[model samples]
Target: MTKQQQDEPPILPEEAVADDSASIGGSSTSESQASLRSSILDYRRENGRTYHRMSDGKYAFPNDAREQERLDTVNYVWMLTLDGDFCLCPKNDISAKRVLDIGTGTGVWALDYADAHPETSVQGVDLSPIQSTYVPPNCYFEVDDLEKEWTWSTPFDFIFCRDMNGSFADWEGVIAQAYKNLEPGGYLEIQDSIWPPVCDDGTLKEDSALYKWSHLLIEACDIIGRPINQTNKRPAMMEAAGFEEIKTTRVRFPISPWPKDQKLKEVGTANQVQLVHGLEALTLGLFTRVLDWTKEEAMVMCLEVRKDLKNLKIHAYWNGYVVYGRKPLSSEDK
Candidate 1:
């Protein structure tokens, strides 16, 4: 096999240990248990969409099953794009001792990584407590905000974050924390897709519903002080955070089933499914809570966007960027 192919981690068939009954903490009534209880009770619901109350509505998306399905589909699509590789950091020969997934979502990535590398300890942290209880023994999930101060006791060998488009208010702070919490020579990999798909042809006009939706979403995120489109700036942010040996790869992610090529056609089909399924869930809160749009108005806009998504003539695609960097071995190396 080629070196690049060899670098990919093999897909393991072993089943991950399940622990559905596990909660945040034990039954003890200690201070730590009380704190955990408070965190668990911090979940809030708005118009059927669940959100993390700890951050006080900092994260825009819902934590319901619809969002979870979208996330899992996106993750699977990414794996398919990478030929089953979970990460692109060149650490094939070395087994990461400790790994951290910043926005763990359902903790599927952490569980898969832990299952692949049984010797590694994988910790997935998120603002919501939606992660599955049954997970690999080596994998653990914690409820915490990534923008807040990190409380990790030890440095990790690798860190991974994906699909966190509108979650972080301060991306720089999150990268800085990752750098600080990573062991020297550790690697950090970030995978995110650019918003507002680009269309080279004239099929996607500025007046199109897709274009209008993208504009509104971008404007809303900008007003909130957490810009959603950071695909281009991530590499520079990592460099500024003192990470070295940085590398970036950009892939054209299809937005609809308009591509003639077989691989891209498959990607486009998956994108269409995700976008159609998540159109309402993705923008309902953003429109109502941020843009002051009524629920009916938001749904009308969503319907228009969905129609545009299914239009094969648009030929639109989002740029997916994978950026990875390593911590310097010593302070002088900086």
Candidate 2:
């Protein structure tokens, strides 16, 4: 990272704050709410999908309503897959005084955590301002790019991030920033799905459109210096960042409803819905902008990929990894 990159400022202004009346259930709208909506409308549009114009092309996916719905569905499915568990870290049972959630899409996890632990102060930051206007008293939302320098005033006891694929060009920089911002013995948890599904039964053919889509998207991301398949390498990166007692857990997430087990079937069913709903939002920008595909051509390819996502006989699943580590209690221990 260059010196300028290391010193990059937050995405939002220092005085920017979420509107308290903008919560999902609230109907009141303030000046801040109108400002937030106008800011979101300023995003660049391509093929009916919106991209973050302020991010300087660091992130590829849209931040529009359709994309936000897909993100919420993903969070819902993850909660169901984990049997309602929020954090898988061993220290989850401990009451954290301060928590920071990076890339907090819609602020769902942060709100839930704050509601569950009223004593904790939770701060959620993201590149988009789509979070609810009404949030808990103990929970707050900010618009900031996590790839830049963190200007938080205090260290956090726990830091959590999810589904941050294709958002950061330097994974090690993010890990190192987390290490620097965490209090001693503080824990960091990251959850993400490995891009490009794997099939063990040979049902997902090499010529399948889903396989082609993955290859094209991965290639596009690689050309942009951000690889989406970094979930498996997170443990090593965390270890290199001076974190201790690192742990990683992997879960198989089916692309369709092909699993015989009830839980797996449910997960696959939910995933099928998520993939189908998000196919365009996930690929339209990348394919059209980076891969030189026309909008119609991209839509046709996405349709083919959606068909494969709903095919029950495919028996394909992506690896979802949850990795966590703790900062040492003392400098000597590190």
Candidate 3:
């Protein structure tokens, strides 16, 4: 989940380059590439739609009832980062001093953080005040926007942001805000995925339907002046925002359980199961109105996308880049 300009998160230190070179290895990806992908982002789908209910986007979570299972499922895979050091440290190691969770949808991560680390204070904020009212003593959920000037008035040692992709209009500003709000030597960790670029053996044809269909998101973000392309810009932007010691890693799940890597296959299949339930709101609400695709078409093609997820040998993967860096201690900066 992420702020605006999410979905296609910016580049990690790897997977792509800031040069916007349009070429990788000996083969250039731009010239004669036949693919219409943007230089800003590689092939990916955007996720994180929890804020739609409050705003004018597609679907709304917690309208009448909360899809607690769906929200928690999306959060479980990345629980690795839910520690003090990793940023989700509630009910985890208490080494972390403080944390701020941006776009905290269900307040699940924040509550978990607070529970795990009773000594640490954690705050979760969203455009919608739809999260559970019950929370850990160390955790609190509020209604706030990461982009509209942070009002917390307190600096934190770690900033946790998820699933605000559709709600952010200025991602760089958000990152800069994280930099500003972080205590020196604090950490920032993020996880998100909703863009789609399937690679069956890396041979999914350029003309493949997914290429065109997934672009609906690209177009929609463009119209809104936010972007699905924000994923690829993290490392550089973080560096520019004045973070250091940056490291980036990628995790990919096949759309289904067809990968040779049984773990990824399992992950992909599990993720796909979740997607089956969330796909309509993700595409129809997130992209349809802007892209003008009908509910029937989205329903049909997304099902195909689900089928592709489990196609064992497709080598198809959607990647999430995990990166963390310390806010430079002012003395260290000198």
Report the C-alpha lDDT of model 1 over 189-275, residue by residue, as the tens digit: 999987777765566789999999988999888888888787689999999999999998877667776776667777778878988
All models, RMSD in angstroms: 8.1, 10.9, 14.9
Per-residue lDDT of candidate 2, residues 1-334 (tens digit): 2252235321111122111212333333578866654664488877776776556477888888988888888888898778888889854577699998988978899999888888999888877767887888898877667887887768898999998988889999998999998998999999998878877657779899999999898899988888998788999999998999998877767887677667777887788898999999888878888999998999999999998887776777787889999999883322
Quote the RMSD, in angstroms, for model 2: 10.9
lDDT of each: 0.80, 0.80, 0.58
Off by over 4 Å in 3: 1-68, 80-94, 206-209, 331-334
Residue 297 miss distance in model 2 (angstroms): 0.6
Count of steric clashes across candidates, in order: 1, 4, 46
Model 2 ranges with Cα > 4 A deviation: 1-41, 332-334
Report the poorest 10 consecutive residues by lDDT, candidate 2.
10-19
Instruction: Estimate the TM-score of every prediction.
Output: 0.89, 0.87, 0.73
lDDT of 3 by residue, 1-334 (tens): 2343254443221122111112111234445442422311231232323333333332223322234566666676555322223443221344467777887767787877677677888877665555676666677665444566665566888887765555577777888888888878788876665465545335455555455556776677778676665675777888888888887766564555555444554565566676666655556554455666666787787777555444444444566666667787772321
User: TM-score for model 3?
Assistant: 0.73
Error of 3 at 248 (Å): 1.3
Clashing pairs in 2: 22-133, 22-134, 23-133, 23-134
Clash tally for model 1: 1
